[model samples]
Target: MCPHFSTGWGNDAMTSTIVFDPLLPWWLIALLALVTACGIALALVRGLSGWPLRALAGAVILAALTGPVYQQEDRKPLTDIVLLLEDESASQRLAERGETTASAAETLAARIEARDNTELRRITVPDGTDNAGTEAMTALSEALAEEPRGRIAGAILLSDGRIHDMDRAPDMPAPLHLLHTGRSDDWDRRLRIDNAPAFAILGEEVSMTLTITDEGAAPEGVRDVPLDISIDGDEPQRFNVPLGREIELPLSLPHGGRNVLQFTTPYVDGELTDRNNTALVQINGVRDRLSVLLVSGEPHAGGRTWRNLLKSDSSVDLVHFTILRPPEKQDGVPVRELSLIAFPTRELFLEKIDDFDLIIFDRYKRRGILPSIYLENVRNYVEKGGAVLIAAGPDFASADSLYRTPIEPIVPARPTARVIEERYRPKVSELGQRHPVTAGLEQEFDGEWGRWMRQIEVEQTAGDMVMTGKDDRPLLVLDRVGEGRIALLASDHAWLWNRGYEGGGPQLELLRRLAHWMMKEPELEEEALWAEATGQRMRIIRRSLSGDIGDVTITSPSGETFERSLEEVSPGRFETQFGGPEIGLYRLENGDQSAVIGLGPAAPVEFEQTIASAAPLAPMLEQSGGGALALEDGMPRIRDVRPGRPAAGRGWIGLTPRGAFETASVTQTALLPAWAVLLLISALVVGGWLREGRR
Candidate 1:
């Protein structure tokens, strides 16, 4: 945009324009000329024959007063620029599309360079950040701004028509040609997650809607395809789902925590790629507010330990009842002095017993309070998937111990009718170190566990002995009834740890782990296999109650299997980290335990549409006077075409050659010398006088 001159496109450029610099004001010069003309006209009209020579002399004088100049410029021509945009995003790498694109680009570049005055600006479109897919049009718009619009003879793109940003396409000054890569018959099947919830109840059925879409043309006779579904990292459950339809699948999670669910369709032989054939959804399993029923025979120091732990958790609803007045303790103190809510025994044990997630009994000795029928109902509750925990004291060893009643069948251990009262530190059994509830507890305290002055002597009848008190007697036991789980803490002195007695052990940590284990949390499972993915890296974990396990078998999304030995970093835990090479689903197996995790995005935008089509760029090509020609036929021939003519044909594409340049030099010369104009005017005047005198 130079103010000196405007440009004109050609092989070489030069320009000229008129500029003025007058010796005298234009108005005064015009007046003098008008007066001279009138004088000569009067002489001619009055019959004087000398007016013609006088008029000629006057014209020469007027011309000398007005100075005139000529101007010219020199310029150098510039070469034309043609954009060659190549999309290298993930979609272009599928099948042989990448090879075809790369070869075609090389051929086109050679041909364009061979042309007389045309050069190529190669722009590569890589994967967009945050799954934006192929940004071919975005790159094109940026390249257009870098160079002169007129100089850009044309723009050529090489891609698989999976561009994500079509709305960002720029206005083209010249034609645009698309050397479309990928075959027309290229087909693929992608699993799409229509709707998925981020959090689901553990026991409730998690419903997810999904669709099986076939891009391009799928193989014929493929009505029902096999879909594999997995929860956490367990073995996949295969089922037949119809193609191209929305399917609602019901899922069940065994534990409350983060759960990874993968739904994948097996790759057919002729499908484009397996990358899009699978989808991964991570739904965290959350427990609905836990309803805990705490029934204490008499309020003790250890009762608040259980109450505080359950109350501190925002997701727990606690219903505690302490029997202040037993059936035999009829004291003279009136009921008006006591502060308590009505204890609805029948409602708790019969009417709505199943509503509670867990029932806790602390130091209860029957005392004829709950009739035998109510105790039988409590036993039946434990056999029907209900969880019950008993914290025993001296009452457990008395004649009326709960083990001597109908509830004894569900108790993991029975009292020996003896109570040991001595200062002794509690210790974890050998099997406890491997069990989920007590695992790593000893390590946490590291021989600094507090001592308990009291422990109820009990002999294991069933279930596992996880903790021991005085002289290796059972301190804690866990067992599974018909369809439920029950735990017995032999001593009620656990509150000693809470009071920091003798440098308190991990009282809160131990209680938290025990509660979660009783509620069946996945992370507290004794035997499990799972993998976690962050970006492209994956961490595979194996937890077992036994010694070292074998190597885990890793199966990639493409069904390629390999083995890697896990490192033991803990007592019963083994794991290893891997940098995934591709973006897709990964399955890991160690013996019977298997897990599935997604390494990258479930379905990348690049693979969402794999087939190459010209429909996306149809309007752009038509507006730019270009055509979409497939590279499958052959590499298009490069040729020079007029700016407005059709730039692409069956086997050829075109570039417009704009001879653009810049001004290199300029010069100006005056029309005539001042001295020469003066001499000519005087001679003309003298000749007119001499001629008039002779006449």
Candidate 2:
């Protein structure tokens, strides 16, 4: 017997296929089955001959009623996709890696494009912003998601193997190969600050832990390395430390507020970069406790004001003394009956003088109670880094004023034995508007302040006259004596502001700033240059008492210098913002003052390991049966392979063959015509009847 199958026929060409579509409903087919079954049953019951032949004839008639069709389609084949990812991050730009990556990428792309039925996808990964390091894996994941999964044959990467987002790696359908860059002998030395306190008590030692480590192919037998340390742009101190070890150093803050401490390791030959070899840590210094000595010559209305102000501050430890009676005015009462205790002048003035941070003399006059010897000690104390504030009154103009005592040498002004008693408003001098202590005081009172009742007449001697009253005489004077500071307020009526006489002024604030400035707070320094950094931007601030502030010179970590002129933001403050191009230490200089600050991390993550290696991406390559090849050896050959097979070898990379395609058009046709089916049914009936007749 011979069997036949039909092919489809379309408008363009002739073809063959086999399909079926029933012409009659299911009830008619069921009725035909019942009639055929009855006839076959009758023939079987009568033992009739040719029973199967009759049934065959009936089946042929039923088949011609049902219709069948054949379908055909036209398909267009799609090319396979190959991804080439190139890394151009900061780490990849080091040494010869940039050249290596460029060359390798060009060659690999050319080779992939030369192959048959292959499409090349080129993606370049750049350095992430805000110090995010390398993000090669993120780029790869995005490329994979955009392309057809079935058509993606393989992926190739050219990088330094410093990927930061390995956890975001995709579940790749094809092999992922890496071509490493950079030399194997590359090495680097870095300084790491393991632990540093953001704040420390001033004049007290704070501990910091640091480690110096050598990475990559470092020289053998290397142990001790010279390290240099500096504070606030001062001279650097050199010390020898063992390599690859943690060391603890105790640091002392010089004054309050941001104190910059710089640590550096000497550069050696064959290192990647010296950027990580230096580090800067800024510590905010806070005073543990401020001790102030308040001495009142005789009790007066304004004496209690000084006590209240000093006692209000939680950080101040106040020691106050009042002389109720002068030695010349001794009473008849016995010494034992006296309620007052000895002032202990010798102990406070000579022995423990250095313990106090500030001393205030309110309405004081040279009396016999404190001898001239003890008064000389006060003058010596001021010259040796002590602070003294003299609140003068009518007594300052008298013959026994402190100007006649042993402390006369350090007095900023001399009284002329004339006291002006009149209502006059205090005013900030033009120079005072530039001085830090009095710079912004007028702004607080809208350029107007309360009145003072009296001011001592004095000569314009030595020191800066920050305030004036009554014929423009110096009302407030500030001067530096040796290493100490002295401020003399000629009037004792500042207490009037505390009493809110005629719309009170910023007397409290003024007095507070004056006290702090006298104690040498860094924020109140007359001549200063400093820079504050946020991210990669820095704000350079210059504070000066002089009206003429020269241009500030900035030095970058790589020894590049830039000069920028400061704009006067206020009376004495000049400031400007700079966007630093790179991360590392920066130096600022204005006249004789200088400052140093660090930007970004001490050791950026990109420079932590400079040498190129396959360790970071080794797991991904192993899981996908891919291999890593060093570009320094040579560019590998590209080849095509079958899926589920090894995609890489010693000197070659492979891409899988994806047989992807698309259908452009389709067509359908009936398998047989109506006349042909009728003819076939007639032939079958005649043949079956002939055989039955012969029997």
Which one wins on TM-score? 2
Alpha-carbon local distance difference test for all models:
0.83, 0.84
For model 1 the local lDDT of residue 608 reads 78
TM-score of each: 0.73, 0.83
Candidate 2 lDDT tens digits, 173-287? 8889999996778898888886798999988899998899998889999899999998876889999999899899988888788888888998888888787788878889989
Which residue pairs in candidate 1 collide? 233-594, 233-595
User: Who wins the lDDT comparison?
Assistant: 2
- Give per-model CA RMSD: 7.0, 6.2
Tell me the deviation in Å of residue 95 in model 1: 5.0
Query: How high a TM-score does candidate 2 get?
Result: 0.83
lDDT of 2 at 76: 64
Error of 2 at 541 (Å): 1.7
Worst 10 residues of 1 by lDDT: 333-342
State the lDDT at 478 in candidate 2: 94
Candidate 2: the clashing residue pairs are 6-16, 6-17, 7-15, 7-16, 7-17, 8-15, 8-16, 8-17, 19-68, 21-67
